[model samples]
Target: MDPYTSFQVPTGDRPKYTGKKLVMLSPDASMKNIDAEASGAALRLAPSSAYKSHEEDYIKAFEEGDGIVFEKFRIAVINANHEEQIKSLLYARRSFQYEEPERYLYALDGPRSSNFGVLLWQMLCRLFGIKKDPPEIDPDPAPKDPLPESPPVFENTGEAYWGLHALDTLANSFTGKGVKLAVLDTGMYLAHPDFASRQMVTKSFIRGESVDDINGHGTHCAGIAVGGTRGESGIRYGTASEANLYVGKVLSNAGVGSDSGILAGMEWAVEEGCRVISMSLGASVEEDSNYSNIYNELAGMAMDMGTLIIGAAGNDSRRSQGRISAVNHPANCPNILAVGALDRRSEIADFSCGGLNPNGGLVDIAGPGVEVFSSWKTPQEYAILSGTSMATPFVAGVAAQLLEAFPEATAREVWDKLVDQARPLPLPVRDVGAGLVQSPK
Candidate 1:
């Protein structure tokens, strides 16, 4: 029922939850039949179209158990706060009652308020089976150039990073020719002279935004993966220079993106026959966390269809201060390659995240990330940034190179070759899994 029409609201008060909500339901709730029940409930409180709009976003119901993962719901609650509204809804729906079969209804993300906190605490303790408190959200700060006093030495190619040079040495026979490589991130600055000769397939998932990358992160990553041998400034950056580029602007110009948009881009990349899909974005999660079932399933499906996904292990650690963080999501999914960052000295970068969680949460490889220079959005046209985000695309480029070398290799075979050829490092497996990523000879 519409919370406003179903319950009385205090005069002049505002609704606490106006944003989207994420919900997880019990295993018994069939997605096929649940729509009618959900719409019926919505009609009791709001217009029928309210549920109709969100219908397409639901994942397919499982066969063994009809559970849905990270299903989105747009909910409003008149003048009552989110917690109060949810409580009232649960009471009315009676789905959470001990006697009811639907005993696992949970609101994963909601308004941040005392009542909401209390509700989440109660739910996590009683239903979600997660004992630890939810981890705080801390986005890694934007990467900056290394200290001026200690500049990194450039390779023979004029690139100050070793990742591309390493790949060039190990896989000189393949240039990722004819392979489709997709980098999904902030939009690209295609007008940059470094990419002037390369024809690119581009699409912007962000509504009302152009494919031009204003943030520079996407262009930087693209440079690492498939940029030309020489930029307008004469620096040789990028790997897989001969590969076909598919630029999917999943994140907006402001460097923010929704889960739905990113997933859509993933689907598009796979459909376009991209052999490698690289993503340098993720959200924080607690240590020893389980992989995201949603992304695990999505990536696994893509892998079965012959596409390999690569993502950053995240840059949430501060080893100098001894604060360690876990691998972030999507990359935390086992089917995807989670890449960590290495410095010029072959040491793990101070801010590169580690593999604290097992099962889909392990770091698969390392790449040169510290003091790395690459192409950026125009006006500046080049940048030097440090993060696991930078390391991820280097591996993606190497994956493209692998595809070029072994044209008939399955996605799993390509993944195994990279792991098999990885140069062993001195760091712990959690810090640099199979060690530095190596190219196919």
Candidate 2:
């Protein structure tokens, strides 16, 4: 009988593993040492460095039963189907820092039904002349000083998207020139007209998949981060208009991917010296659950190597139903900046996750997300979508701009500048950590 036969997944719940396990080696462990240890268990491991220039072969080796190690992050992905294999690895635990089952992650785009419900509510409020009560400001027993006034409400015009207006991107002089920015998602539409002339590097970590985005999620996100003007409206949507784009197809065309592929993309970004990496994907976690230690370590390492990783605070909340989910994985890792979603009214999006868990699971900032307009896959050319997924790229693009402006600043310094310059809002810190993200003027 198969061991999985006894297992039953609850409806709507994602399976915890893909019959694979992730292992983080001890800091000083090398490929030579690890190989010797694995040989004792009759296991063969392949190093990613050997196939760095040939990713297809690397993935093929992994799929062909060779335990593959990401040398930079000192992490490995191995099959976990046999009990003896797992036991053997556990027996040599001293050679590893940590080990866990790899979980599946999905694109953070808002669910269609949720987006429709939000639109309906807004329409009803407008038709009935219903006004929402002012948000109650958190009282301070010993207030140091009054908070800055909220930013003016913005509306999209033929000239630009409301997000760009809200961030004052039009007045900003920096175009993020020379900055190497990466967007890891479903992939991008290579032939998108708006981005035809821009500098771009592309790769796919998903097995048997190309970097061409079948799903529009990645194209929309890449547009928000670095695309040019829209053809019809001449509207400006992207932030870092001249940044060198690095497109990493970590998630499959189905908008789902394993941690192994995601990690591979991350390693590639860091190796290529990317200044900022934007990830609009995550797996939902319970309010009481802790973040993934593996991601936390990897993100910290990436930061030390001068790369900043930004991730979407998952779209799992139902504020209308009085439920707010905690910030999701990868983003919940302390070193990765977690961005939440905001609407045109500058209020938190109804479906935006919050910081319910302590420690690393906190929303670090907010960006325009609801009904966001940007480039989509061909035939459509453009689209309007909602979710923290939209918000994340806005922040990533701004980070690239800041990097160009302050050429000598470290990755951590850029993170500080973002929080320091954000326009404070009349909302709780749990929902909007440093308030709304703003472009430097």
Tens-digit lDDT track of model 1 for 1-441? 111111222345323322322232333544334455444444222221222222122211211212222222221111112333334445655332111111100011111232244344546765967655334234234343342333232254554346666544434667789999999988689898877889898877565567898888899989988886554455557878889999987766656554545655676677789999989887666797677665666677777888999989877676655566888777888889899987665667777788888666889998877667788887998887778888888899889999998989888888898888887765577787777787677
Candidate 2 CA-lDDT value: 0.84
- lDDT measured at residue 310 in model 2 versus the true structure, 0 to 100: 96
> What are the per-model C-alpha RMSD values against the true structure?
13.9, 3.6
lDDT of 2 by residue, 1-441 (tens): 111121223458766567778888888988888888778777778888877775485676566655788989989887665447656766767666667778878888787686676678778887999876333332223333356565467898887889998788888788888999999998999988888787689998866678999888999999998876887567899999999999998887778887888988999999999999999999999888999988998998998999999999999998776778899988998899999998898888888888888878999999998889999987897899999999999999999999999988889999999999998887777887888898887
Clash count, one per candidate = 6, 0
Per-residue lDDT for 414 in model 2? 93
Best TM-score among the predictions, by candidate number: 2
The alpha-carbon deviation from the true structure for residue 387 of candidate 2, after best TM-score superposition, in angstroms, is 0.7
Q: At residue 154, give the lDDT of candidate 1.
A: 24
